[model samples]
Target: MSAIMSGAISMGILAWIWANLSAAVGVSTWAGFMGTTTYYASGERFIKGWVKGMIANMVGVLWAIICVEVSKVLHVPNIVAIMTGVISFGIVAEAKWKNLSFVPGVYIGCSTTFGMLALNGTYLSTVVALLMGSVVGLLSDAGGELLVRLTNKKETEENLVEKQG
Candidate 1:
């Protein structure tokens, strides 16, 4: 199978498994999906991508929380909007750090935080779901590579047998 096909299959299988497990565990499946996507989008190796995505996501969540708190404390007109702008700037500024350079991850994390809040979900649960998703991403990637290797080996063996025949 082609690499793309292998990767897609791997991801599809893992996603299905995660969705069922997450639903049973009361975790946010959506958050986990986002985490998996973010891991792939980072385009780094498994460990590096996971670490960068998690860091960026945490920064985003922190900024989002601060934005909400500051808006509440100030109680000024359009304070939420103002705080959002500040947080947005902060999120971008965080990209200066090598470990947090995945800007999209930061944005996704911030949006996920807001989404969780809107759904009356807890941040801790969201974090857990995201972590699970990242793990799934890693597994899916490994599975895809393994599948490709196995397929290649089988093809080589068949070619050798045909030549001998």
Candidate 2:
């Protein structure tokens, strides 16, 4: 499991982040996917990791419900539900790539889809959602590895010195 934040804790953070994000953007899907990725990446035992992931998502869904309730009060008329779901799913996809190369585009597409479409096509939203999910998983995995390097805090002046390209 990854370390910057422990597995369950990371899930909570992911949930919190996603919930807030969805509330702000009128979507809640991407939050749990990203949380699950962290659950896998975090340093828990394999079975424990899966359990944490499931539980974390259970809590996240509850949070989503809360967001839904709030939206009723705010009267924002969320057209972006699909976008939130897609981007939330994107969190799982980004887990595999730390550099997040595809993330920005996916986020835009996912976010826009929710904003604009009422009943989005399976052909388009589903495809984009899956692609975005994969992207997020990739990025999350890469991000963990990168954080490891960053936190090692190794080296001295020589390490900082630039090498010839």
Q: Using lDDT as the measure, which candidate wins?
A: 1
lDDT of 1 by residue, 1-165 (tens): 788888889988999999999999999999988888788888885788788878877877777788877887997999988998988888888778888778899888888888988899877877887788888988898888889999989999999999999
Segments in model 1 whose C-alpha atoms lie over 4 Å from true places: none
Residue by residue across 62-133, what tens digits does model 2's lDDT show? 333444455556655563464356446754575466433333333433433333243543324433333333
Q: What's each prediction's clash count?
A: 0, 35
Candidate 1 accuracy as TM-score: 0.95
Clashes of 2: 35
Lowest lDDT sum, 10 consecutive residues, model 1, at 55-64
Give the C-alpha miss distance for residue 103 in model 2, angstroms: 26
* Cα distance off (Å), candidate 2, residue 85: 29
Model 2 compared with the native: what TM-score?
A: 0.30
Each prediction's TM-score against the native?
0.95, 0.30
User: Which regions of candidate 2 fall more than 4 Å away from where they truly are?
Assistant: 1-121, 155-165
